[model samples]
Target: MKQTTFLLVFGVVLSFCQAQSETGGEETGGEEEHVELFTTPATKMGAATSDFGYNLFRALASRESATNIFLAPITVSAVLTQLSMGGSEQAERQLYRALRYHTLQDPQLHTTLKDLLASVKAPGKGLSTAARIYLARRLRLKQDFFSLVEQQYGVRPKALLGGNRDMKEINDWVSQETGGKVQRFLAKALPRNSAVNTVSAAYFKGKWVTRFSQSGVMENFQVDGGSPVRISMMQQDNYPVKMGADSDLSCTIAQIQMQDDISMFIFLPDDVTSNMTLLEESLTAEFVQDLSMTLLPAQVSLTLPTLKLSYSTDLLPLLNDLGLAEWLETPDLEKISGQAATLSSVNHKVVMETAPEGNQYPSATSTTSHLSYRVDRPFLYLIRDEASGALLFIGRVVNPKDLSI
Candidate 1:
């Protein structure tokens, strides 16, 4: 069984909150001092990657309209950008165009990317990211390229010995990187013609700032208005959330606070059978940031499902659709080595588990208002790092019961 050329792993686990709890659901961010974020090379690069991620999501969602879709845009873009550093001029240009980095004004792209990675994966941020380059035992990288990659990306290239040993080695690295949450990353043997391969993995375990009043209860979730599935829906009363309505998209957008300066934004359509095409089309980095700053505070009765889902698929076709056919067909990776190399395969997998778990015990004085926000239908969501304004994960849930897609 031949395996893929590249593997992108995205695993997220929602654990307990151990931060200092707010005594009541007080209105936050209303009369606060709004400080403008200082611009940096990494932030510029992050904005570009966020745009690319939204485009990729649109392509995937258009293809699988009824299935759940989840991916780490930052991870995929980072891996591709790292690979581009090893490409020839033409190949690099092609890859940059695909990533929408042609117009980016970042001079120190790699250095800033290093900084962004460090910031997101910093201790207690609930995000861990790792990238590696695997070369066939018969091949070798240029000394300069090897040093650059090692110094910038913080990983040294390794040999891909064929068969079960190769499988174990790669999977073991993945398991170690994600603290054993992601195991057996490579399910089968490497392809007979495998050459230069890249693997990127990220593990995120977010802790909510406020704890729910109690455990989840059985509730009905409408799956595209076809049939209702009974899902364990978590509930929170008098939640201090940033929420607003978007008339253009016919959806209500809400932001739920999480620890470590992270926020989870949810977009729920007006009707069960409503089409989310408009909302998906309108997702951009700038637009999302505007929502974050502009949406008003509210105290609502919030109810959402306890999500445990995983999705895996090949992103090659999608990349081709995104205008990378020429590069994928005949990649010019002369910087890596003199020998000819081709990158025609890329695989992606994402696993996420989040529930209502925290140390902030619910108090009697948390209530503030009587607004309601119930997510009983299909919805879209994204996890963002507020400190860096980087999109960590984007996904849509059409049917929570159907775990895999």
Candidate 2:
């Protein structure tokens, strides 16, 4: 079997940064204001996060499959990073390959994650990321490993007392962190063979600066060139949204602000102009870094669909497919504990929604409506932190009506 070569980049889970109050658009008081709050200073780590995330998404979301895939790569990467902190050299090496920790050279991986998490958890972002490892009772961890987790990732180990009861404990932790969006994470009972379980959960609630209209109208959504279905199409006419057509990726890109520091990038591919195969192959972390600069301000007669997506499960199969065989097998986690540990599971859960705030027009007084990005068909989207370029979530929405099914 050939080993999978992952094109590494780190679009951290829903974490990104730095528009210091520029202009959200023209102010109401006759000032030549812009909707941009402040200009963000880019960071290498942030770009890495996006690169890692996009690559991972393409790996999982194949066109032959359902083509509707959604996952928070940052949450998974952060959890893996936490585990790597206590893993053996071999395990660490595999993790470094998968998560691409080497991408961030200066501040280092942990420091970069700490800074990114801080931004995501800040007031009003409506995003949360958490990682935890549960050890069976009487299984003591090394003091140094515990200290490292505390100092670097700010997570503490929760005791697993019973089988079913302990699963509830993990479930409750995820539920609280995700604002009740997630419940009952672990389905099966804990195995005696495994002594450690690593889990990560992320939740983000982004309100578009220019909101979608609550009263959506029925419109045709082209599933492919052959199939077109009517769906509730959300509209925002004459909206000032960043727009562009990426000839390289063959997708119409649009950026909608969730907050000054956070925004979402939508990539809509056409039937002939876009090929998912080529698009997937070309999504590098470096490419995403230039997104902000690549897209220009345009007056959009935006037509989007009300979106509600939730995906949850273990990514072990996908990892195995990604050629992370050693990762799934028993690894010498001597640093974490004397007891042997195998990665029994690497679990993830994510949910996202784009509800309307009733056609929220930006504060801009007047501007030429030049371009448009209408999401009338299947497309891809990235929720990112604009300042730091950290990717919070990456997904492909093929059929909105059948996304969850």
Candidate 3:
């Protein structure tokens, strides 16, 4: 249960970070500025959150018979949006000012990520001291945010917002910002009358560079390790594939090239179940970087399952398993002192899709959206490092029968 909790929280954080990074290139100004106001810093948070987030994503993705799993990336975005919307221009400036300094404290969030990767079963070749230090900096930044949250909202959030009852208002603001995804998680984990406020948000969009033909779509896809569900499976033949030889663990990574150098890496577990622990152990940032460097285009057939899933998670036990027990147990108010508050707990929800839209196509084509990679069975998936093409981490939903509550 502890491990599960750690993994769940980790997944949500990682997903949120990755999704935020996807929008890095967009131009901001006008309505884009408003979204930018919300997205820009959120994207930075992605980089900040990626360290822990990707580690958890990879851990779950490496498991056997994992399928149809969804991880929420909304936590950071929700917090940021909540703060931005509920404050005055002065408050906004102060919040950003605090975040800037806070982020600087950690430098980079990927350090703990690299460390956690080292702890896994098939620990990949280790990272350089520089890389580890860089990641540590990021973790420190996250800690900084924790500190800011506490400082801004503590027992007297009114100091920041001008009243004693601002906590409920902040929570309400969060509920509206996230489209209702995070409010429940907050209500469950936080003290009902506590005046602390936080935010989390996540969004992702991916399209096959070369769209699969609906003419080739098939149904009743056997989702390898679980109950069979009718789904549209996308197939590509003779694509480039990479196979790796490691002691006790043979693995394959399938790259789905998207537009503008973006790609999704599909990691296939060598053994259906037995080697999961080894894969988890072996998964690491260095391994992913190395794997990205080694990929060569090859001719092969790719079959992908199409699915849509949304879910929420409670991550107390998960955070403890991951060595983040202090925040959960002691309520680290010091880190959040600048804001006048403390985080009781962090909760998250995620929604994901592996399907495409039908309206965009010609009327002559089938209206049903056909997406390749029907992940009906348990398998690992990752939105990863493209140039180095390293899979940050992969997630496996082995037992759809078991759900997060």
Best to worst by TM-score, what's the order? 1, 2, 3
lDDT per residue, candidate 1, 285-362, as tens digits?
A: 767766676555655678988887756565767888778888887788888878877763465556666768755644
The TM-score, computed over Cα atoms with residue i paired to residue i, of candidate 2 is 0.81
lDDT of each residue in 1-405, candidate 2, tens digit only: 111122111122101111211222212311211112212223565665666677678767763354577878878777777888877788877777777656445546677677877876687766776678776655566777878888887777665686777778888888887778766666676775556777877776677778654446888887764577777777765666665565555566777777657788887775522246666676655455445543446556678887777777676566665557776687677877887766666777787766676235645546534345568777777888766667888877777777541
In the range 268-294, model 3's lDDT, one tens digit per residue, is 654444235555555443344344433
Superposed by TM-score, candidate 2 places the C-alpha of residue 38 at a distance from the truth, in angstroms, of 18
| TM-score list, all predictions | 0.86, 0.81, 0.52
**Between candidates 1 and 3, the lDDT winner:** 1
Query: In candidate 1, what residue range of length 10 has the lowest lDDT sum?
Result: 6-15
Relative to the true structure, candidate 1 has a C-alpha RMSD (angstroms) of 8.9
